[model samples]
Target: MTEAVQIRPEQFPLTRECPFSPPKEYRDLREEAPIARVNLLDGKWAWALTRHEDVRTMLSDPRFSADRSNPDFPQMVMGRVQDDDAEKSLISMDAPEHGPARRAVLGEFTVRRMEALRPRIQEIVDERIDAMLAGPRPVDLVRELSLPVPSLVICELLGVPYSDHEFFQAHTATMVSRQSSVPDRRAAFQAVQTYLGDLILLKEKDPSEDDLLGRQIIKGREEGTYRHRALVAMAFLLLLAGHETTANMISLSTVALLENPDQLALVKADPARTLPAVEELLRYFTIVDTVTARVATEDVPLGGVTIRAGEGVLGLGFAANRDPEAFADPDDLDIERGARHHVAFGFGPHQCLGQNLARMELQIVIDTLFRRIPDLALAEPVGKLAFKDEAAIYGMYSLPVTW
Candidate 1:
């Protein structure tokens, strides 16, 4: 008889120092046991969903609640002051609450709306490319392009002054960096919250006809249902979630392309193929690994296993995208795999609200990069590229690039 396969605590900590790619153990575990108990830091246990189908089901299933208000819900980082309030955001709420809260901003992120922003997005991408070309050849893409393009775009969209980007970016960095101490992270959160709260008050005083926050404020005022705290929470959510995920994707996808010359050539030769390629790359490099955590509302059987009430489950986005059952060859980055069915943005009602904007940003960036710098390649050796292995969102600290 075979010994029951188990994921050792140290091997699979929430903060594993490894490449952005999914761990090989995930594939092994998915084949042997899709749903297995994993020991976390402090000897806590959480269910890890690895299979593609299982992950999809778990994400959409109502029984798997993201109610962060629950006592047993796993915290992103243990022992943080604003951890409770941070968890109460849309990502952590259950259906009835999560749905409407998400709907409030859905109109801004729809594919149609995102399409309308393409020209503006393209302009932003072009401006970044021009800046990169003007600067040092081996500049860090994270600082010049990956971080700024999305950062500025999100700022403009959310009605925040672009001049304040540096402060917000620093605050966001400290909050998301795993290396930061509890107090430091808490301080960062408080700073961002306070900053956004002030911004909300300003918007309330003199609202604009456009911009997401402005529109939200107007809607809330008209409906007479807007709570100041909710506005602050949504603003924080949009700023962090809107930019960070896409920024990581842009950097990671560019790295993946530079690594695979053939694929890069394919994309460079025919820019029309970028959208599908972006989809494939998004699947290939699922960076937000295990960031989405949900608690079991009640006893529910899943994937031939019973999950008890109050037990937490993590939807391993990285693992699920690489499930062999979901794709013909999960590891191979086939540009034409028609990977639209992939769960990179997740599934169900709580799917990423900014997915459209994300896709648009990726599309424009890829298109403009190839058009402007067809000879683009990584400046440093692939092995030498530094990854933020400890980040909640798997990413490269700096992607040095040259043409």
Candidate 2:
């Protein structure tokens, strides 16, 4: 038997030098070491999967466990212990448990449900844009448009009051930030969990069938399948994820389009082009790259490399979306490319549940923004804009714009 070699690997997740692009080192890694070992934040090492094919296969396979409670699970940072709330999150569960948990709430995010909510989403977009136009020139788009649209939508869906968005948004920012200390992250997690627990208790007293969380609560009580504690954790995950990820994408996608005028014109000329434009943007700005870490349950050879049982692997979604093997001229932002196969929202059973809603929201926002204000442009140079470099989710902290 070949003795497994142990060595300190190159640091993983090299800082994204370009705000809108993946790290240059990722391209080099994809070419030379598609499945190479690399160092993580906590001094531990794991195999980093850089190719789209390998990442898709690995994520779909049952051998790789998504359970955070697993002792052998590979962590992005060290010494971070998951609390009970973290353990019950659907994103952190494997099959059997993951399947039923996901199914229970899956109906809420279906295409029909999202379509029914489309008019409201459009209204919210217009309302925000109206306020932006009325108030001032060179407004911070992040605050004015990007954040509130989805934040309001998600709040309504989850039955959480949108007036308290600041509280949970602050907590979520700390939770996903790489620079946040372990204690800070834990505190953020607890704060959101407690808030959701309180809200769910109120819903239990007066459940509404129309609302997502209320529906889940009623079903959970009748079926006895979903526990109150588990529901709180689930709500916490949805509320944070429901707003943060889509909000960042909105800001990042807007900046990308503004920078590429020719592409922006395409979306502006024909409203029908907006859908594919959104998909291309999703592929190009594959933001949530680091969240899909998994631990191998058995020996698996991938991309000519063997990932041993008990080993850790990161499915680098940004690199995979940009892989030349998956899309022709992956670096270029082509609105017509229709790169729907991209892993921006991930793949397999763990694919984003709210993707349909996200897609519709982006399409409406982009189309409406450009149509209403054709002269819209960045207030400052793209390089000068503040970006969330230290956060796992790639996006701008603030986007100042004028029309």
Candidate 3:
């Protein structure tokens, strides 16, 4: 039997040192050896699950656990910066713990809830559009729309004051950025924790009748199943995950659409085309490259390779979404790919709880942007557009555009 190829941990730090997109070497490795050992930041090794089927199987397998409390678990970017207890939110929980915590906020992200927010999202979209049009000929969409829309929506949902957005947004960017220093990353995590801690207290004293934070506080307290730290952590996860990923998706999708005028025109000609187009774009972009880190609970053979107990597994979502085996002509942007299955929002027990809300925001933004500014075009060269290179969430710093 051929010995398994080992990828040294020092070679791949989660920082800007790693390529934003999977490099040619990764593609080659995926094909040659689906399960390869790769070095992580701290000189520790991790099993990189590269193939589409292998990633899907690993994500769904009970042996792969998301719990970060395990002492042997490799420290991913955020885990390295924050305390273990603090990282115990939904993304880090396994099975039974992950389920109820996720369930606590699932209803608020349902299609029904998102559908009700459609008109409000539309209004937000129009307001942003109007502001953009009223600006100089060219404006940065990342600044004007992509970032603000979701931030504002999530703010309202969590009942967080918009005044505090700058502080949180800065922290959010630092926490997600690959180039951020260890001190900056730790500070960012603490900033978010402090902000959420205060918000929880505020909610307890004067609850908003219907917001998600308020609702969670009520449910948590009523069930007598809540801890102060847990409530803060959960709220932090919701606010950050709720907007940050969707914001990146919106920016990335807009960039993709603008790059493909034919598809953009197709969606522009008929607003109804936005939904399907968004799905295809989500699959094509697959902006969230990796899911939360998972650890091997026991010895598990994945894709003919044996993973020993207590190894870390990183699910390369970007690779899986673009796998030719799963997606036909995966490189081509087909706006109308019927019933596409992409792991953009992740999969299984840990799938994104706010997916419906994300889709609703994307749909409304896309439909309204094209309708309001039919002549929108990229203000800068596509290649010149600066992207957040080192972040777990792939996004642009500024998406300049003009109508």
Candidate 4:
């Protein structure tokens, strides 16, 4: 057999020369070796799928398991292995278990349910903007606007007390941060888990039908389906994902819109275009790039390569979003692109559970922010901004802005 070409693995995350664009090397990977092997932070090798179709296919295939507890599963970041007894959130499970777990609380995030939340989401956006307007010049939008809006919304939805927002938000930040040591991440995980576990017990004892967790608790009891551990696991996943992803997107999207004047003008001119604009923003700024890594349970044909059983695959969603085959001028921030098909939310059955709610929240926040502050602009040069370069989830750490 002809010796397979040997290409030294480029480090995972392939550092970005520009914050708004993927690393320039991705273009080469897509054209030359779409299924190239890459070295992760831990100096481990895994197949990194860069093409859109390949990523979607891998995500949809049942053979590629999402169970992180699998020792062979790829670890993109250098950290401790996941706890075996840890709550098996939907993001970390495969079929059969994943489907039922997802369906239980799926009703809470449907398009209809999210649509019902539009008015409240708008109110939350407006209220935050009100505070921003009242504050002094050159406010940090991340603190005043981006962080609180979605945090408050998810808190209200899950019936977690909004007053305790700071508690969970701090722990979540540690959990997602790349700079956090393994012990720090573990501590953060346990802290939130303990908090949610206690909250679930409370909800079970005294259920509130209106809240998402309360409803789940009541339903679990009525159906005798979910045990205490399952309910706690569900709450942990929702609370962490609920706020962090959307909050980062809010901060990052604001920066994207401000930087692209022409594109920003389009959304400002037509209010109806905001929905598509939100989708395009999600595509362009795929913040959660590291979320989708899976281990193959069986030998799988993927990206013209046979991923043997027990091998790991990292579906680079950020890279896929920028694939030329999937998008024309993929790097451009075209608010009109309507790139809803992008895998920014991951593809297949394990796609983001709260995407519908995320869409509504982003639409309302983006539209209302610009409408209320028509002159909104970055307070400093974009080059001077401090991005979350050390974080697994990409976003600006602090977006300073003025109107």
Clashes of 1: 1
TM-score per candidate: 0.95, 0.96, 0.94, 0.96
lDDT per residue (tens digit) for residues 67-179 in model 4: 98888888856676257776677888888888888888898998998898888888888889999999898999989988999899988999999999999999989988877
- Report the number of backbone clashes for model 4: 0
RMSD list, candidates in order: 2.1, 2.1, 2.2, 1.8
Query: Candidates' lDDT values, in order?
Result: 0.81, 0.85, 0.78, 0.85
10 residues in a row with least lDDT, candidate 2: 1-10
Task: Quickly count the clashes in candidate 3.
Answer: 5
What C-alpha lDDT does candidate 3 achieve relative to the native structure? Answer: 0.78
Clashes of 2: 0
The superposed Cα distance between candidate 1 and the true structure at residue 381, in angstroms, equals 0.2
- Measured with C-alpha atoms, the lDDT of residue 242 in candidate 4 is 82
Candidate 1 positional error at 140, Å: 1.6
Position 106, candidate 3: lDDT: 83
lDDT for model 4, please: 0.85
Worst lDDT window (10 residues) for model 4?
Answer: 1-10
Which whole-number lDDT from 0 to 100 does residue 398 have in model 1? 89
lDDT string for model 2 (1-403, tens) is 1222333433455668688678887887787778777776667778888899988998889888887776667676545636644546898888888999999999999999999999999999999999999997889999998999999999998889999999999989988887888898988877888888899889989899978889998898889775888888788878877889899989999999999999998888899999999999999988898677899889987777777899888899999999999999998999898799999898988888889989999998998898888999999998799999878787878999997
